[model samples]
Target: MSRNLRTALIFGGFISLIGAAFYPIYFRPLTRLEEYKKEQAINRAGIVQEDVQPPGLKVWSDPFGRK
Candidate 1:
Protein backbone atom coordinates (compact mmCIF):
# COMPACT_ATOMS: atom_id res chain seq x y z
CA MET A 1 0.00 0.00 0.00
CA SER A 2 1.04 3.59 -0.60
CA ARG A 3 2.21 5.75 2.31
CA ASN A 4 -0.73 8.15 2.01
CA LEU A 5 -3.27 5.32 1.96
CA ARG A 6 -1.60 3.64 4.93
CA THR A 7 -1.65 6.91 6.91
CA ALA A 8 -5.33 7.50 6.11
CA LEU A 9 -6.22 3.94 7.08
CA ILE A 10 -4.37 4.26 10.38
CA PHE A 11 -6.15 7.51 11.26
CA GLY A 12 -9.52 6.07 10.30
CA GLY A 13 -8.91 2.98 12.42
CA PHE A 14 -7.87 5.11 15.37
CA ILE A 15 -10.94 7.29 15.08
CA SER A 16 -13.23 4.26 14.90
CA LEU A 17 -11.60 2.78 17.97
CA ILE A 18 -12.01 6.03 19.90
CA GLY A 19 -15.62 6.36 18.89
CA ALA A 20 -16.35 2.77 19.87
CA ALA A 21 -14.73 3.30 23.26
CA PHE A 22 -16.61 6.55 23.80
CA TYR A 23 -20.09 5.15 23.12
CA PRO A 24 -20.46 3.40 26.47
CA ILE A 25 -18.39 5.81 28.60
CA TYR A 26 -19.75 9.19 27.46
CA PHE A 27 -22.87 8.78 25.33
CA ARG A 28 -24.53 6.10 27.47
CA PRO A 29 -24.28 8.15 30.67
CA LEU A 30 -25.59 11.26 28.95
CA THR A 31 -28.57 9.35 27.62
CA ARG A 32 -29.16 7.81 31.04
CA LEU A 33 -29.02 11.25 32.67
CA GLU A 34 -31.52 12.60 30.20
CA GLU A 35 -33.83 9.71 30.97
CA TYR A 36 -33.45 10.31 34.71
CA LYS A 37 -34.24 14.02 34.28
CA LYS A 38 -37.33 13.16 32.34
CA GLU A 39 -38.42 10.80 35.09
CA GLN A 40 -37.79 13.47 37.72
CA ALA A 41 -39.80 16.04 35.78
CA ILE A 42 -42.65 13.62 35.53
CA ASN A 43 -42.51 12.78 39.23
CA ARG A 44 -42.21 16.43 40.23
CA ALA A 45 -44.99 17.72 38.00
CA GLY A 46 -47.55 19.82 39.89
CA ILE A 47 -50.52 17.94 38.51
CA VAL A 48 -49.38 14.73 40.17
CA GLN A 49 -48.27 16.25 43.47
CA GLU A 50 -50.61 16.24 46.47
CA ASP A 51 -48.94 18.50 49.03
CA VAL A 52 -48.73 22.22 48.38
CA GLN A 53 -46.41 24.78 49.90
CA PRO A 54 -47.77 27.22 52.50
CA PRO A 55 -47.83 30.96 51.90
CA GLY A 56 -44.96 31.55 54.31
CA LEU A 57 -42.73 29.14 52.42
CA LYS A 58 -43.82 30.13 48.94
CA VAL A 59 -41.06 31.71 46.87
CA TRP A 60 -41.23 35.26 45.44
CA SER A 61 -44.79 35.79 46.66
CA ASP A 62 -44.43 37.95 49.73
CA PRO A 63 -47.77 38.41 51.40
CA PHE A 64 -46.28 40.20 54.38
CA GLY A 65 -45.22 43.83 54.31
CA ARG A 66 -41.64 43.79 53.08
CA LYS A 67 -41.59 46.90 50.93
Candidate 2:
Protein backbone atom coordinates (compact mmCIF):
# COMPACT_ATOMS: atom_id res chain seq x y z
CA MET A 1 0.00 0.00 0.00
CA SER A 2 1.05 3.61 -0.51
CA ARG A 3 2.30 5.58 2.48
CA ASN A 4 -0.73 7.89 2.46
CA LEU A 5 -3.17 5.00 2.15
CA ARG A 6 -1.58 3.19 5.08
CA THR A 7 -1.63 6.37 7.19
CA ALA A 8 -5.26 6.97 6.45
CA LEU A 9 -6.20 3.40 7.38
CA ILE A 10 -4.30 3.69 10.65
CA PHE A 11 -6.02 6.93 11.54
CA GLY A 12 -9.42 5.53 10.72
CA GLY A 13 -8.77 2.43 12.79
CA PHE A 14 -7.65 4.50 15.74
CA ILE A 15 -10.81 6.57 15.60
CA SER A 16 -12.93 3.47 15.41
CA LEU A 17 -11.17 2.03 18.42
CA ILE A 18 -11.81 5.19 20.42
CA GLY A 19 -15.46 5.21 19.47
CA ALA A 20 -15.84 1.53 20.36
CA ALA A 21 -14.33 2.14 23.79
CA PHE A 22 -16.57 5.13 24.39
CA TYR A 23 -19.82 3.69 23.10
CA PRO A 24 -20.80 1.74 26.17
CA ILE A 25 -19.69 4.35 28.68
CA TYR A 26 -21.49 7.20 26.88
CA PHE A 27 -24.29 5.95 24.68
CA ARG A 28 -25.34 2.83 26.56
CA PRO A 29 -26.20 4.65 29.77
CA LEU A 30 -28.31 7.19 27.89
CA THR A 31 -30.24 4.46 26.13
CA ARG A 32 -30.72 2.55 29.37
CA LEU A 33 -31.93 5.66 31.17
CA GLU A 34 -34.42 6.35 28.41
CA GLU A 35 -35.76 2.82 28.66
CA TYR A 36 -35.99 3.10 32.42
CA LYS A 37 -37.87 6.39 32.14
CA LYS A 38 -40.36 4.88 29.72
CA GLU A 39 -40.97 1.97 32.05
CA GLN A 40 -41.37 4.26 35.04
CA ALA A 41 -43.84 6.46 33.19
CA ILE A 42 -45.92 3.45 32.32
CA ASN A 43 -45.85 2.14 35.88
CA ARG A 44 -46.59 5.53 37.34
CA ALA A 45 -49.50 6.00 35.02
CA GLY A 46 -51.02 2.77 36.21
CA ILE A 47 -50.56 3.42 39.94
CA VAL A 48 -50.93 7.15 40.48
CA GLN A 49 -53.47 9.70 39.36
CA GLU A 50 -51.78 12.97 40.35
CA ASP A 51 -48.36 14.17 41.54
CA VAL A 52 -46.40 11.81 39.38
CA GLN A 53 -42.68 12.44 39.34
CA PRO A 54 -40.80 11.45 36.21
CA PRO A 55 -38.08 8.87 36.56
CA GLY A 56 -34.65 10.58 36.71
CA LEU A 57 -32.13 12.07 39.06
CA LYS A 58 -34.15 13.96 41.64
CA VAL A 59 -33.47 17.66 41.72
CA TRP A 60 -34.74 19.57 44.72
CA SER A 61 -36.45 22.82 43.94
CA ASP A 62 -34.53 25.89 45.10
CA PRO A 63 -36.25 27.40 48.10
CA PHE A 64 -35.83 30.87 46.63
CA GLY A 65 -36.92 29.63 43.16
CA ARG A 66 -33.86 31.12 41.56
CA LYS A 67 -33.10 28.10 39.37
Candidate 3:
Protein backbone atom coordinates (compact mmCIF):
# COMPACT_ATOMS: atom_id res chain seq x y z
CA MET A 1 0.00 0.00 0.00
CA SER A 2 2.95 2.36 0.66
CA ARG A 3 4.55 4.29 -2.28
CA ASN A 4 7.94 2.57 -1.99
CA LEU A 5 6.32 -0.87 -1.78
CA ARG A 6 4.17 -0.17 -4.85
CA THR A 7 7.19 1.00 -6.86
CA ALA A 8 9.19 -2.06 -5.92
CA LEU A 9 6.33 -4.34 -6.88
CA ILE A 10 5.95 -2.64 -10.28
CA PHE A 11 9.66 -2.87 -11.01
CA GLY A 12 9.73 -6.55 -10.08
CA GLY A 13 6.72 -7.30 -12.24
CA PHE A 14 8.26 -5.54 -15.25
CA ILE A 15 11.50 -7.48 -14.86
CA SER A 16 9.60 -10.77 -14.62
CA LEU A 17 7.61 -9.99 -17.77
CA ILE A 18 10.75 -9.13 -19.74
CA GLY A 19 12.43 -12.31 -18.62
CA ALA A 20 9.43 -14.43 -19.59
CA ALA A 21 9.26 -12.87 -23.06
CA PHE A 22 13.00 -13.31 -23.66
CA TYR A 23 13.11 -16.97 -22.62
CA PRO A 24 11.34 -18.17 -25.74
CA ILE A 25 12.66 -15.54 -28.17
CA TYR A 26 16.33 -15.60 -27.15
CA PHE A 27 17.26 -18.29 -24.62
CA ARG A 28 15.36 -21.25 -26.11
CA PRO A 29 17.17 -21.17 -29.48
CA LEU A 30 20.59 -20.96 -27.79
CA THR A 31 19.82 -23.98 -25.62
CA ARG A 32 18.55 -26.01 -28.59
CA LEU A 33 21.25 -25.09 -31.14
CA GLU A 34 22.63 -28.59 -31.44
CA GLU A 35 19.19 -30.12 -31.78
CA TYR A 36 18.24 -27.58 -34.40
CA LYS A 37 21.44 -28.26 -36.31
CA LYS A 38 20.72 -31.96 -36.38
CA GLU A 39 17.17 -31.37 -37.55
CA GLN A 40 18.34 -29.09 -40.34
CA ALA A 41 20.97 -31.58 -41.41
CA ILE A 42 18.35 -34.31 -41.71
CA ASN A 43 16.06 -32.04 -43.66
CA ARG A 44 18.77 -30.95 -46.08
CA ALA A 45 20.29 -34.40 -46.66
CA GLY A 46 17.64 -35.41 -49.18
CA ILE A 47 17.69 -32.02 -50.95
CA VAL A 48 21.32 -31.85 -51.96
CA GLN A 49 22.41 -32.75 -55.53
CA GLU A 50 25.80 -34.37 -55.77
CA ASP A 51 26.48 -33.35 -59.35
CA VAL A 52 25.63 -29.69 -58.98
CA GLN A 53 28.28 -27.41 -57.55
CA PRO A 54 27.58 -24.18 -55.70
CA PRO A 55 28.17 -20.96 -57.59
CA GLY A 56 31.38 -19.01 -57.01
CA LEU A 57 33.87 -16.71 -58.71
CA LYS A 58 36.23 -18.31 -61.20
CA VAL A 59 40.00 -17.76 -61.28
CA TRP A 60 41.12 -14.74 -63.31
CA SER A 61 44.33 -14.65 -65.38
CA ASP A 62 46.03 -12.00 -67.54
CA PRO A 63 46.40 -12.79 -71.29
CA PHE A 64 49.77 -10.95 -71.51
CA GLY A 65 51.32 -13.03 -68.67
CA ARG A 66 52.71 -9.91 -67.02
CA LYS A 67 55.37 -10.62 -64.30
Backbone clashes in model 2, listed as residue pairs: none
Q: State the lDDT of candidate 2 residue by residue for 1-67, as single tens digits.
A: 9999999999999999999999986777566776755665676565543345566747434232346
| Per-residue alpha-carbon lDDT of candidate 1 for residues 36-66, written as tens digits (9 for 90 to 100) | 5576568666752225655556343322225
Off by over 4 Å in 2: 34-67
lDDT (0 to 1) per candidate: 0.69, 0.69, 0.71
Candidate 1, lDDT over the whole model: 0.69
**TM-scores for every predicted model:** 0.45, 0.49, 0.52
Off by over 4 Å in 3: 38-67
- Greater-lDDT candidate between 2 and 3: 3
Q: Can you give the lDDT of residue 29 in candidate 1?
A: 58
Residue 53, model 1, lDDT: 53
lDDT of 2: 0.69
Q: Clashes per prediction? A: 0, 0, 0
Candidate 3: tens digits of C-alpha lDDT, residues 1-67: 9999999999999999999999987787678877766765686675645335456744433322456
- Candidate with top TM-score is 3
